[model samples]
Every structure is written in C-alpha cells, then in structure tokens.
Target chain A: MENFTTKASAQPLKNADELIDSVETFIFDCDGVIWKGDKLIDGVPQTLDMLRSRGKRLVFVTNNSTKSRKQYGKKFETLGLDVSEEEIFASSFAAAAYLKSIDFPKDKKVYVVGEDGILKELELAGFQYLGGPDDGGKKIELKPGFLMEHDKDVGAVVVGFDRYLNYYKVQYGTLCIRENPGCLFIATNRDAVTHLTDAQEWAGGGSMVGAFIGSTQREPLVVGKPSTFMMDYLANKFGILKSQICMVGDRLDTDILFGQNGGCKTLLVLSGVTSLSMLQSPSNSIQPDFYTNKISDFLSLKAAAV
Target chain B: MENFTTKASAQPLKNADELIDSVETFIFDCDGVIWKGDKLIDGVPQTLDMLRSRGKRLVFVTNNSTKSRKQYGKKFETLGLDVSEEEIFASSFAAAAYLKSIDFPKDKKVYVVGEDGILKELELAGFQYLGGPDDGGKKIELKPGFLMEHDKDVGAVVVGFDRYLNYYKVQYGTLCIRENPGCLFIATNRDAVTHLTDAQEWAGGGSMVGAFIGSTQREPLVVGKPSTFMMDYLANKFGILKSQICMVGDRLDTDILFGQNGGCKTLLVLSGVTSLSMLQSPSNSIQPDFYTNKISDFLSLKAAAV
Candidate 1:
C-alpha cells in the first residue's frame, strides 16, 4: 500500500485501470460526487456500473440528516440507481447508532432538534423520542410572566438538518443542556452549507447545531463525516479494511477529511461545493490522494484506455 | 483621582461618601442591578434618587435588545422608577446608532433577525427595514425543487434577542451576508442567556447570531455592552468623560468588561446573575473595582456614614 497519508500534494489521477486494481472498496459521498440534487450528473451511472463490474464494494455516505436510509433508498430508485439500504450510511442513522453503541439508558427519552429522518431512525432503533417537527409550530410567547418548561427525562439532544428550526426548539434544547443533569449534545454534522436544490445553496445542519453550541457554551459529539464515527461503523459493519477503501467526494472539510481521519485513500471531485481553484489554493491544507473533475472522469479515463 | 484599574482583588466597597464625591456620572446596567425581571431590586429607586439628589448624572445601559428605549421607559414607569427615555441606552438603540455612525446607505435596506424592538429603533432612526417579526411566521418548505430567494438590496443584517427567531430568518440573514456583496452583519449583544421572566433563563441573541456565524463563516460587528459602541455613544451624548463615569452592574463578562474596556470605574452587584463565589473564583479574570451584595448596599453604606 502507498503512503498516501504523507503525500502533501494531490496528484491528477491517471491510469484508471491501475488505480481500480489497487482499491477493493469505494466509499462515495452522494450530494456532489454522485448527483446534483435530483438531476444525476453525466456518466455517474456508467462510472458506478463500471465499479460494480470490477467487483468493487460500494457504500454511499452522506452528511445530510434530513432523510432516513429507507427514504434515501427510494431517492436512489428514483434516480435509477440500484442501491440497497445496507450500503447507505446517512447521518440520521449514525445518530441512532451512536446512542445504541453507547447503550443509552432505555428509560430516558431522546430530545430531537431535527426532522422526520432523525425521528424515524430513533424509532427504528427502539428509542423513545420527542421534539422534532412537532415543535416546529410551537412558539415562545415570551409574555411578561412567561416561563418555558422542558421535559426532565431527556437524556440526549440530537441536532441535525432541520428546516423547521425555531426559537422554541432552540430554547427547549438549551434548557435540557443547561438544566437537565448529565444530558448529551450530539450533532449530525458541521457542514456549513448543503445543496437543498440545484437553484441555490441553503444553510446547512451546522448552522442549526451552532445555535445549540452558542446557547449551551459546549461542543457537541459529532456523529457524521470528519468525526470517523461513521467510518468506524461502516468498517465494522462491512468487514472492510481501511487500506482498501477509497473515499470519493466533493467537499474537502467533510469527505476528504473523513477519509484522511480514517486512514483511507481520498479522491476530490470538483462537481460539488468546491472549485478547482479552491482545492489548489495555497491556504487549502486538506489534500486528497487524487484530484479529478468529477466521478465520471474515471469512466472517461477507462474509455480512453479502451 | 484614585487609579482603580490595577486593583489585584475586588475590595468590599468602603467609604461610600468618598466614592460618591469622586464620580460625577454613573452608568448602570438595568437587569440585575435595578431589577431581576419585572420586580425591581430593593432600594434601587432610593439609590437612584440619592444619586440624583447629589447632582450625579445617571444613565441606564442594558444588553437586552428585546425592548427599545421607549418600551424600556414604560417598563421603568411600571416599576415606579423615574428613568426617562434619555437616560436609557438599550442594545436595540445601539444597533441603529451604529448604523448612523457608519453612515450606512439609505437606499440599501436593513434585514433584521430580531424582535420589534430592533425594527422600531431602525424605523425611528429613519432607516428602511425588512425581515424580523414579519419573517417569524415564514418557514422553509425544503421540497425537492425548492430554491430559497433573498433580497439583493439588503445592506445589513442586524441580529438581536428575538423570541420569534426561525430558520427562515437565519437562512435569509445567511444569504444576505454570503450572496449580497458588502452586506454587513451586526449583532446587538452576544449575551449567552437572558431573563425573559423571573422564573427561568432563556437562550439569548448569541444563539440566533451563532446560526449566521456558522452559515456565513463571518463575524458580526457587535453594538452592545463590552463592545464600547454603547459606551462611546453614551459618553458623547451626555458630555461626560470615561474616567468620571462609574459603571455598576452584576455580570462580569458584559457590564464589568464594558466598564473596563471603556476606561470607566466598575462596581459589581450580586442581585442579578453573578454570585459572590463565581466572582471570587480563581479563574475569574474580569475584576470590578468594588463588590457589593446588591445595589441597595450603597444606600446602607451612606446611612451608616451618617
């Protein structure tokens, strides 16, 4: 195995056959590398099919905590991709998996500051949950004599991507963290921005998590990419070695850092949030093992080889 | 004048007559020193009366941006205090004052992520404002093809303590700061928690501002206590020197730091948030010139001297 860890500079990946022959498993980021919103990027299916034909194990990892694995499977089906629920590692599942691994007190309830995805995952994990989209419509009247109340049984506050975020939810989460004894603060991911649609960038789950960070004056245990929690879980679940896995993604801070943190080979694709100039900028300290224009670049290389 | 700056430890404020004879002006923090929530601190009114009788100028400064100076005047009246609007310097006013000082363009509007207090101040300052309470009801649908829209002509995003804070406001403020060129981000105060009522603590504006901080990756120009914006404004408005103005408050981070930052004398009152033990802790770096049980301690000292 090559010492890709010490490599300071990212090289343009050449010789697709040689690179494919070396790696057995490929961990992919879905948002930018696989597709842009609902519209699949050109040659993605071909590239994924080529990897499948080569007897390569594939895993789709995403920091977007807005959808459950079941929901993601349906999305993949809509995109004409034959991905199974077992191969998908969304951060929503990571939150529930994290609690299960820790053996969170089954009697205590989990307070959610996220969406249906997190709620669904927690339910599937056999955990009692409260406060997600249910608290979206709840408002803090803040009258002259008003005092907010929170559940005392909440053991953990799991924060993820939530479009229905409001002051009521923030206040409830803050109270649980500040007043509740031995309460946990968990963040799905610290992604700054996420592609909600192809039109423009929307504020990410990191923004919502930041509210809790400021109010509680505490750091959360992140369960998503760049934390290696997901990476470890995937490795253990699939019986894969870190040396044989290549992480393919667009974002440097999340996907590339996740691979680097887990001691795996990383490939940077320029199809998502990052630009070629940004990746090559002098200030960019995160250097992937290989740099390419998009995921489909490997398919183009293989075709040229043919 | 005695140099109170290098006091190694906070001494019990002795010789109240001597202290009263020296300082010509007093700047007071409202929340903890004068009142907790709606209930006024014992002897606060009497202390204010004594200061006025001695021909000492008085100004009430607060980091609570939920209410404008006019609204605060009503609050003072309800509490049986004769604090006029001129004697008040709330952070909401500081937001508008800061914009006026910077000579922000009148054509470009301001987007607010706060309550009506900030909007009222902006309107009184003759500035066109959008967002704030109007956006409280708005939400992000986040459908598959959803694309968030933002106002392009927004020149600034002013954040304060808003009970109605929602994801829509956060997303809008983030978009303005990121997409709109030269859009300034302004925070009224970064207080971690505030006394929404006498019952329990509530999450402060800093939590809402943190959302923008995370999404935009930009720091806001704060226009509240500890920033010296309010101090400078009050000094210029009252024609007083920093050396002659004594700042009295309970909090160490905001009030005491504000006085120290502005080169004013500081006295800590334990009636609001800070406890004697917390103030006397070894880790405590912010030191006030005097430590007292409450604001009424000044009255007790004066009576004892007689």
Candidate 2:
C-alpha cells in the first residue's frame, strides 16, 4: 500500500514515455477529459484509439451519477467514440454495485434522491427502488394539522446528482435516515462543481447530498470517487491490478485523490475546473503523480517526440 | 463579558423566584416553549399574561424563518396570545434587519431561497427581491446545448427554511456566489431540524443552506440565532440589555445556545425536541443556566411554593 499521506511532487509527464508504457490499464473521468458538456475535447478520440491499439484496457469512471452506463455509451457514440457500456463504470452503477456487494435483502427497498440514471441502474440490478424524478414535483406544505410521513420499508437512501432536487426529496431522505433504524445514507459523490457547460460551473451532486447531511446530521457512505468500493469492484470483476491502472482526471479533491486513495498512479489535467496556480498552491496537499495539459496531450507529446 | 466557554451547572429553576424577579425582559422561543405545531402548550397564554402583569417586556425570538415577524404576530393571535409584530423577532426579519444594518445599496436586488415569510420580510424592509415560490416549478434540463442563466443584479442570496427548495434555486445561488464579484450569501438560520408538527422531525433551514454551502464552497453570513445580529438588533431597537433578558426555549443547540451567545440568562424547557437523557448526557456541553418542564413550569413552581 502506498503512503498517500506523503504528497507526491507532481512532475510534468510530457517527457515521461516510460510511465505510460508501464500502465496496462487507464481509468478516465468523463466530462473534463473526454468532453466538456455537449462538445468533445480535441484529439480525445485519437488518443483513446491510440491507447486501444497498444492493447491498453480503458475504463470510464465518472462521478456524475446523472447517467447510467447505457446512457454513457450512447453519449460516447454521439461524441464519435466507440466506447462500450461494459467499459463504462459510472457512479450510478456504483450505487447498485454497492448494494449488491453487501447482499442487500431482496425485500428491502431503496429510496433515491437522484435522477433517471440511479433509478435505471437500480432497476437493472433487480432492486425495488422509489423516489427520484417522481418526487420532483412533490411539495411539503407546512399547513395546519399537517404531518410528514416516510416509507418504513426504505432500507437505504441513495443520493446523487439531481437537477430535479427539491424539498420533498430532501425531507423524505431526511426522515428515512433519522427515523428508519439502521437505514443507510449513501452518496454517489461529493464533487463541489461539475462541468455542466464549457462556459461556466454548475452545482454537483454534493449540493443535493449536503441537504441530507445537514438535516440528518449524519455522514453518508460515499460510493463514488475517493471511496475504495469501485476500485475493489473493478479489481474483483475485471481482474485488474492497482499498479497496472493509472487514474487520469482533472479535479484534485475527487478525481486525483480517488486514484491516490485506490493506490493507482494519478495524472492531473488542466482542461477542466482546475488551473496551474490551484494545482501548485501550497494549500493544495493532494498532489498527483504526474501533470499534463489534457489526456490528448499523450498523443501530442508522442507525436512531438517522433 | 461572561465567559460562556466554561459550562454552567444547569440547576432546576423551580425555586429560583429571585431570577424571575430580576429579569425585566423575557425572550421566548415559540415552537416548543409556547406551542407544538398549531396547538398551544398548556397555560402558555396565562403564563404570558402573568409576565405582562408583572411589567416584564416579552419578546418572541424564533429560529424558524418560514414566518416573518408580522406572520408570527398573526400566529400568536391565532393561538390566543397577544404577541404584537413589534414583539416578534423572527429569523426572516433578522435577514432583512442584517441587510438594513449593512446599508445595502437600494439599486441591488436580493435573491431569496425561502418561504413567503422571507420574501415578505425583505419587502417590508424596503428591498427589491425575487426567486422564492416563483422558482419552485422551474427545472434545469441538461438537454443538448443547454445553458443556465442567473441575474447579475442579485447582490445577496438569502437562504431560509424553504419547503419549495429545488435545484433551480440551488444552481442560481451557486452561480451568483461563484461567478458574481462579492455577492453575499446570507443564511436566515442553520437549525438542523424544526418541529413542523408535534408528530415528527422536518428538515430545517440548515438543509437548504447546506446546498449553497456545498455548491458555492463559501460560508454564509448567518443572521439568525447564535450569530449575535438579532441580539444586537433587539438591544438597539427595543432598548433592552442582555443582563435584563431571560431567554427561554426548548432546543439546547439553538434556543439555549442563542441565549448564551447573546449573554442572556438561559432556560431549557423539555417540552420540545430534547429529552432529559439528551440534556444530562456528559457529551452535551451546551449547558443552560436553568432547566424546567416547560414555560408553564414558572406558574406550576409558583403554585407549589404557595
């Protein structure tokens, strides 16, 4: 196990061809690396193709739980990429995988405070789930003689990135955690801001999860980045060693730290929310193993070397 | 200045007649001490009548921001208690008062993430406001080529106990705080939970505020209890002193801590969310100066003394 506590001095990976040669598998974070919102990043498809030709296994690990693996596969197709659903390890899938890993009772239902992705993933996983986009229009009117109620069958509340997030969902999730005995509070991820568009920042899943944390006063069992659940799941299912995997992402807190926590080599890219000043700031203690302009820099650097 | 850091041994105030006689003003927390939901606590009207008869100035200080001082005054009338609007200092009113104290520019508009009480309070305080119940039905569809827009005129975003809390409000607030230069984030109160009904726990203002905190990654300027903004407002507006005021309430974290933070004599009533076990627990560091069954205990203890 690597001592992640001691920060690795992030060096420029532009000249480090040997580092890339040693890795058999590459784990990617979507949104910033593959594309920025609706548009694909330049040279992403070519870089991925090059990696595929070199017999390197690729896994798309996204903290955005708004889309399931199937949806992500369609998105890849729309972006002119040939990524498959089998290689996409989205956070939405992680929630279902987490429940399956624990051998959750068949009768015990899950309450979702997310989007269609979480609901669809849970359905595919054969778990009875309720309360996601359906609860979007629900209102808790504190009228005279009004009483709030919760479903007793709710064994776990899965919180994710929800654009339809409202008070009813927040209160419902709160009730389950506070009232239900041994009810698990699970968070997809705690990313502060996500690249919703190439133009500006958008509130992430952490904002929705924060409401539950504040109301219930309980920390959630996060199933997304920085959590070893996905890493262990991938290791068991795909038979990949941590040393052979390199985690490439843009964010320091979630993406870069996720790799370091999973004992995988980390590469920080500057194409997303992070900047060079932010990466090198003394306050930023989470240092990645290598730094580059973007994932496509692999192709650019290799071409320049030739 | 009283050193509230050292825990004061909370004594049963059943026989503390002198403490009652010395207090010229009594600040009461309405929810647990006066009423539970719409039902008035036993002998609450009589207790207030007795306090008024003794020439004690009564002020209702509530952390619940769902109601403005005027709305709270109406609630008092509905409960058969004669608490005028002047006597009520709600957290919503505190938000408006905070803006007034800061001498906020008249041209700037305020964005609200709360109930009508906050909107009404801001209106009464002579501030232009938008985005409360109106934004409840709004949705952020992450469709192809979608863009989220926010008001540039928004100078402050006031978050309170909002039942209509949704992702639109969360995203707009996040944008204003993160994108706009020096845009203030104001929270009415950060109470973990509120007694929406005597039956169960309802998510409080903190839950809504937590969304903004998580998304914006900025600490809000809290104007509610334990912030001292309301305390100073009451002192200046009503010519009251902390020494002459006895703060009575049910919740230890909010009401009791608010009193202590304001340097007022504190009393904890067991009629609300807290239990005797929770209060007496060694881990409970927030000790009130006194403890009793409820506000009606003042009368019961007096009768027992006779």
Candidate 3:
C-alpha cells in the first residue's frame, strides 16, 4: 500500500535482455523458484551457471528458518549448484546478523522456540541459548499446575519455523518475555501461507509467532523476507544499491513484497506456490515487475546460450 | 455492555442476610473463591456447610478441564468439604452433557488437544476419543514435510487445558476441522487469562484454542465459564429459574459476567484473583451484585454463629 512503482502493467517480458542489462545483482528465493519439495526444478543448475557466466552477483534469499545458512549452503551442492555460504541468506542468518548489529551481549542467552538452524547461527554469532526441541521441553508431562521454569540469563526469546512448538515452549517464551525485564522478543519469519508441497499448504511459522503475539500482547521484530531488515543487511554488506538488484521468487507475498519494500525490481515465477491466476488477480496489492512461466525462462536471453 | 445492569457501585454488604435471602441456588467458582492455589481457603468448608444448611442448593462450576468432576469430588473430600460428583459442573462435565444432549455418535471419536478430564467425561458418556498427554501426539519430531495423519472416524476436535499442546496436536486438530467434513471444533474453556498462582498469569487453554482458531480461521463451540451453555444445562436439570441462582466468584470476567448473562445475582469475593482495586476500576465492565472481603464474611450473619 506504500507509494511504490509497479512495472506499469503485469506483462510477459518483451526484452528480458534490457531488464538483465539494468541489474548487476540477482536475488533469488529458494523454495519454489529453485526447487519443488526436495527435488530441484529443471534447468536450475544451468540457470545458475549461466547467471554466473554473465558476471551477475547471485544471492539465495529464503524465509526458511529451519535450516542454517551452512545447511542451505550444503543444499546448493546437493542441487548441483556451486554456491558459498556467504551468498545464502536464510531468515536464521538474518536474525543472528540483526542481533550482532544491535550488539547483543555474549554472556546473555536466548531462549529458543525454533529448530537447530537458528541455534547454529546464534552460536556462530557467539551467543548462548537454551530450550529447543532437543531439551525436555517437547516431552509430555500433564501434572497439575506445572511449574513454569525460568532462566535468569535469557535476554532474548527467538522463534522460528519450529515443528517442535509445544505448550511448555510457548510458556517458556511467554515467561521469559514477561518475567525477564528488557527481554527481547524476536521472530525469524512471518510467512502466512507456507507450502509443504504443491497441493498441501498448512499453517506456517507465522501462526506460532501469532500465538505468542496474541498471548503476550507484544509485537515481535520479524527479520525475514518481507521485512526490510534483510534488504538493508544485504545492501550494507555487499555495497550494492537497491536499484541495482532484482529479486526472483515464486511466492508473491513474502518474495515480491520484499523486493518492492527494498525498491528493487521483482520477477514472479510460476514454478512454485503462486499460480498465474494469482498475478492476474486485481485484488493483489503486491505486484512484481515481470511475470514468467519458470525461472528457466530467463535462460532464453543468456549470452552463453547464444 | 448489553442491556444488563451493574451493581451501580461496588458497595459494602450492609445487609448480608438480605442479599443472601434472594437466591435459592448458590453457584461457586472453584479456583479463587473457594480455594487459593492447591490449598482450600480458610473457613471454606464451614461456609459451604452453613449455606447448605440454609436449604440453598450448592453447585461447583469451574473452567478447569484438567480434572474430571469425580476427580474434583475427591479434592473436595481432601479439602474437608462434603461435595458430590453430581454437584460439580466442570467444563469437562459440560462438554460431556452437551455432547449427550446432541446425541453424539458413539462410532465417531473426538480428537483431543487437552488433558484427562475431558477424556474421562467423554468416556463416561460412551463417546470415543483419542490424542491427549498419554497419547503419542504431544512429543516433537522435526522431520521435513512430516505427513499429518488423520483419523477417519473423528467427528469433533476437543480442546481444553493441555500442558502438552505442541505443533503436531494443533495441526492434527486443525486438519480434523479443515479436512474432515462436518467435524465440529469444541473447546472446554475460553478463559482469557488463567493463573497457576496469584503472582503468575500465563497463557491458558484459551491460548491453545487460539492457535487452532488462528490456523483454521474457525470459531469453536466454547463450553466453559462466561458462556450460557452451563447455565442452560444447570437450569434445565436442576429445575431452578436463572434468577434463583447467585454466582460467587473472585474474577469479574468469567464468573460475574456469566451470572450477569444468566440474570443471576453475582457476589465478588476478594479471597481469589480479583483484587478490590480491580472492582473499583471503571475500566472493568463486569460488576457483582454483592461483594464481601471473603466467602466466609457471610459466616458473621449465620444462625449457627448467632
């Protein structure tokens, strides 16, 4: 709803070459745009190799907080693409980076309501943490008036994509925020509709975030795709202007809106979550700069192919 | 907020005898009014006995679904009070009665996101149920794209005070409501704020209920305090007019508002969660018909004492 420019009309690329010529940096969303489920989409490796041959700076930006950047870096090799851990910026990485930027205390621990990815990142950033799935927090114990334990060292409560979220974890996080004075409530992502598979779309990590928000009546600092935090982090670290970057993603809400928020051009690919009809729908406020059938469609304009 | 009347001003009980004379039925809220934490309040047994001797029908109604009415009956005996299981109308009891009233199918099972109370009540009513603390649902397994299994015979999903509520249970219950056609979503309570101790107020079963509601975007048939379901059930079975009943509770929100909704007299007791300052605050909408420092304050006017 902000005063932002769309690409005049949502149309097919007439000159993909002209758009490609204008952008030096390419930001790609991982889930649907690169791969569907565990399998890589067709022409992904070739597309990455082609983009690199053209001397374009490629970066993989994902809202998946379940995996560390290191884990995601390994995923690139598994998908037959050569990429560094530095180029992969997951929500967990963004959360750790943001915490580092704010000069979060090394002595203080963060209580976690997420998976191992966020934990790994925080550890790499030199932070101590407690209460994840591995802890006894996830086990069922329904005794009357279950005493909620607390940690004095917990300075922040971080929530991400946690399959292991339970009453005790929520209670732990709520108590940490309420009981601990000046405790920071941080969420890794806020994707409303996350795709499990092409057909199955269950509630995302945002629902977990929304639960805490509802109970504590507090807002979380979401350091994910749609938030401008990632964009700022990317720009500051890479020394690239926002206008020099173009975001390519499958989902409209997080990926497209994220690019729009950063003043970067966005390309919506149909190989993932968003259908072509979603882009055509006039009710959608988040419109991308261009629409294509697949991420591989840009391959037609590649100089290496010619 | 409706066309209901307030006590105008929370005044001191000048004529306790006169206020006590109006209602034939006495409904008491268990947790703060009768008992504080695990221990029964001082003079609770004596006051209850005196009220019963006065030819007043006494009933214990609570939103807590952790213990069954039979279990609650044992607690009453432990606390040195003569209370029958029939005299207790816990949320679990209410849920069972409501299901019986609707003639819930014995063939269909209810998926539970709660404790043993509702499970016991449902079993007593000859209804099948699955998934509680004892069931394997509350434990966490963070495998990617974990397939959500479903019970084809699940006709309803019941939520209560689940200390073991996790993502899988929430998702399982959600899938039952969303995927299974005509599957009812039932909640034992909708307590906005519940506490273990007076000093601590954490997210209650309502927060667990809220997670499913937020995910499925479905409203549940709430069967607890502040809802008219228990009032209707008590009125029909006991053959007493709503006006004949007087509700005594510590909290203004659930107990007082429930009494007000049923057109019954409400007595706010200071022996529990609601403080005197809370009643005096104009910001609070619910007000009691009569207020005393403690439930035992009426003992001063008792004939046994006289």
Candidate 4:
C-alpha cells in the first residue's frame, strides 16, 4: 500500500502501466465510462476482464437512482458485460441502507415521490408505503395514503426521480415537512439534469428537494457519491483499503472529487464530463491524478510486481 | 389620510361593513379572489363594480409569475371583469422595474429562465436577452450578450420560471455569477408553489432561483409581494401614502405579513391558503385587521359616514 502526499503536484501519469502499478481496487462510474445512454462503450468488457485477470476487485457505483442494482445487472448482461448485482452500488440502495442503519421505525409510514426501485428497497428494509393510486372493482377514491396518515406520523420523507410530479405532491410533501420540522428528509442524488439524446433534460427530484430546503430552511443529508457516508459504506462493505483504491469516472465534480476527498487515487475518463480541455486548466478544487481517453484504455495495464 | 395606533387587545371587526369602513384602498390577491385556475371567481364583476362605485382604488398583486400584467388583463376580460393592465402588479414586473430605476445597464444581457411575459418586459425596458434556444435548435446556449462590452457587463442574472430549464443554463448562469461576484441576482418571487388545476404546482421561477442559491451559497434580492421592494414600487407608482393604503391577500405569510412589515393595513381573505383556525394558533406571525370570506363579501359594504 502507498500513500500519496496531498501536496504532490497533479501531473499526467505516463501510461496505464505506470498508473495501475500501485492501485489494488478499481471503482468505476456507470453512466458514461461503462456505457453511454444505454449503449456500452467499446472494449469496456475486455477492460473489466483484464482487471479481474490481474487480481483487481471492481465495483460499479452510480449517482443515478432511476434504476436498481438488479436492473443495472440485467442491463450490463444485455450489453454483453460480465457483472453481478452485488458488484453494483446505487444511490437508491444507499438511501435505503442509510435509513435502515438509523434504526428507522418499520411501522412508521414513508411518503415517496419515486418509482418501484426505491419503494421495493424501502419495503424490503421493513418500512411501510403510503402514496399512489390503486385499482379496485368498486368506486375509486384518491386516498392520500401515507401522505394523510404521516402528515402527522411521518418519520422520514424520501425523495427520488418522479417524472409525474405535480403541485399536490409538492404541497403535501412540503406541508408534511413543515408540520414535522425534525422529520428526516433525504434525496438520492443532487443532479439537476441528465444528458439525453445529446441534450439536457429536466430530472425533477434534485430540484424538488431543493424546494423543500427553501421552504423549511433546513439542509438535507445527501446519501450518494461525493458524500463521505457513501464512501465509508463502500469501504466497509468490500473490505478494501482506501489507499489502494482507484476511482475511475467521467465526471470531475462527483467521481474524481469523491476519490480526492476519500483518500483514493483518481483517473479521469474523457468519455463523460471532464474533457481534455477542462483538465488542462485545473482549479485548486478540481484536479484528477491521471487522465485516460476512456475506461477501455486501462485494459493494456498489468499489475505492479509484488 | 388617517392613522391608528396598534392597540394591544383590539378585536376584529364583527362584519364586512365595519371592516370596509375602517379601510380605504383595497389590495387584492390575484389568484383565488379575482380568478381561480384561469377562471375568474364567481360574482367578481359585480363585486369590483360595487367597490368602484364607493370610490375605492384597487391594486391586483400576485406572487405567481407565470403571467404578467398584459396577460392578466386579458384573463380578467375573458372572465368578465373590466380592468386595465396598469392596475396589475406581478413580482416579475416589480423586479425588472426596480432594477431599471436603479440604472442597472439597460443594454447589458440577462439570462432569463421564466415566462414570455418577463422576457417581453425586460426587452421593453431595453435589457438584452442571452438565454434560450440557439439558432441551430440543437441545444440551449448560455451566451451572455454583454460579457466583454463593458467592465461591469452581465449586469444582472434575473431568475423567473422556465419549464424548459436544464443543466447548461444553470451551470453557465452560476459560472457568470461566480466570476462577477458583484453582479446582481434578482428573484421574481419565492412562493414555493402556485395553485393550478385545483392543486399546488411548482412555482417555476421560484424553485430554480432557490437552486442557484443552494449551489452558489448566495441569496438573491427577492422582489415579490412580501418584500419591501414591492411596497416601495407600489407607493411610488401609485403616488399614495404607504400608511393610507391597505394590503389585501388570501395568504397570511405573504399578504398580512407584507402589510405588517410595510406600514399598511392588512386584510385576510379566507378564499385561498390561510384558514381562520390556522390564524388562532399562537405561533403565527401575521395578524390581519379585517377578515372576510372573499373580496365579494367586502364589496357588499357601504362607506361609513365621516
């Protein structure tokens, strides 16, 4: 194991051979490094295969909450990649796990503004569900569900991506928050937008969470990447040393910054957010240790002589 | 003009007639009293006609920025109420007017994330437009119009509502704000949600403006109903003494609180957000001088003999 001093000048490493000589575990970003918009990047499978052959453990971490680990595993398999559900870490899982770790009451209701992934995870962890419509053979009434019940009994309010978000949902959530000022408010991620079809699209959860903060004047505890909680959770789950880990990701703000803050070496992949031009002018805050054109470039590396 | 001292135990007037007798100018909340979800409230035409017969001047103000004065006037006419555009005051209009009065660069560019009404108002006042769809129509570009034209260019970043908001717009807007730390950041309003479709909806501009504050760690100069800037703008625009004018609204947090802070009489209507039961609570900060079910109830009164 090696410890790089914080004052070391951030210079581009010579090649993948020199870069992998000191690292043991590889942390990969899912969205752009492994795949771009549902399409796997070229040589990603070979890169992972080669890393495994050299005795390096791999972990797939993502800030996106729209998908579950099972779904991600299926998608990776469909794209011809060898991976398992246990190897993936998602913000949705992190959120549920965090709530479970806090000894959250199982009988207490939760008001969710998201999809099945978060709902299933929370329920599996023993929390009750509250909102949404149900199909009945008789007269249908829009029961406010956990919203009305927990508007008084709510122990926590979990927020995630909901494309069908409307005013009543926002008002109900905000009112519940105002009534119980001490109730926990958690957001899966804080990304304001996501790239789709080469254009940015509105992803509402982050913005809606931001609205809760404005009304309550209270900051939410984010449980995704770049947050120390997620990093610690990962370290404990995999029995990996932080110093021997290398975070390979596309975004400098989240992926690279997470590595920098968590005492791990970081490799910036140009396939996503941090471009070559952006890396050339390094601000004091954002600078990655090594630069690679894509995650596939690391396939040529061999493990350091032990 | 007349003034009354705040008596510690002054009881609320028993009826609408006594409530109107004690007040002169009537301020009205635009949303529920004058209109409800694009349809004017019942009996509003005759209500305003009767109030005007008794020499009462009216001001229609709203914290909602989805529509401007011109749009409001058209909506009023369609709903059978005769009103001029000059009688309406929106938070967006007040923000732009206030910035213009201070001699903020009329020619400098502004990045707007709101309705067409705000853009039209800013352009009419001689400010340059910088944000929106690009010529190729592939992406929304953030090219500030006057960044290099003058030393103090990019005069201000005005936030409103834009249903089409994305990451590039926020990223660029925040970048400009970071570079020009002295550049003005003005929020049209801070209402967390606006009533729509018989439910509360995201007050578009207000939410996005909140996100910028969270990211940049800066607060904007909010120019809306409860803010003093609205009071000052109204006083100067209408040439009336602040003490003589009354602030009428349906929401206690925005309307009654606005009057309390601006040295004017406050009236609360039960047709909107605040309920009488809610007001009885000891924790409430707003207390209204008059209470009525709606503006129509107030219009039924005859003036008290001098």
Candidate 2 error regions (>4 Å): A1-8, A141-143, A303-306, B1-8, B141-143, B303-306
For A1-306, candidate 4 gives per-residue lDDT tens digits of 123244444565456766665888888988779987667888888888888888888889887676778876887899988898888888877788898888887867777755566776776677886552110011212332212223577777776655433334444556666676567888776665544333323333565566556655566788776775677787888777898899988887678777877888898888886678787665635677887788776654332222
- Candidate 3: lDDT of A8? 62
Number of the candidate with higher DockQ, 2 or 4: 2
Which of the two candidates, 3 or 4, achieves a greater lDDT against the reference? Answer: 3
- What is candidate 2's CA lDDT for residue B119? 93
What's the TM-score of each model vs. the native?
0.95, 0.95, 0.85, 0.63
Candidate 1 error regions (>4 Å)? A1-7, A303-306, B1-7, B142-144
- Report the lDDT tens digits of candidate 3 across residue range A1-306: 235555565677656777788999999998888888778999888887877888999999998887899998998888778899999999988889988999999989899888889989988999898887675355435356656578978999998867777767777788888789999999888665555544456667776786676567678898997888999898999899999999999888788889999999889888887888888888776778888877777777554435
Task: List chain A TM-scores, every candidate, in order.
Answer: 0.95, 0.95, 0.92, 0.85
**Residue A289 displacement in candidate 3 (angstroms):** 5.0
- List model 2 lDDT by residue over B274-301, tens digit each: 8888889998988898898988778878
Residues A36-139, model 2: lDDT tens digits: 88888999988999899989999999988988999979999998999989999999999999999999887999999998999999999999999989998887
- What 10-residue stretch in candidate 4 chain A is worst by lDDT? A132-141
- Residues A78-127, model 1: lDDT tens digits: 99999999989999999999999999989999999998899999999999
Give the Cα-based TM-score of candidate 4 against the true structure: 0.63
Q: Of the candidates numbered 1 and 4, which has the greater TM-score value?
A: 1
Q: Calculate the i-RMS of every candidate, to one decimal place.
A: 1.5, 1.6, 3.4, 9.2
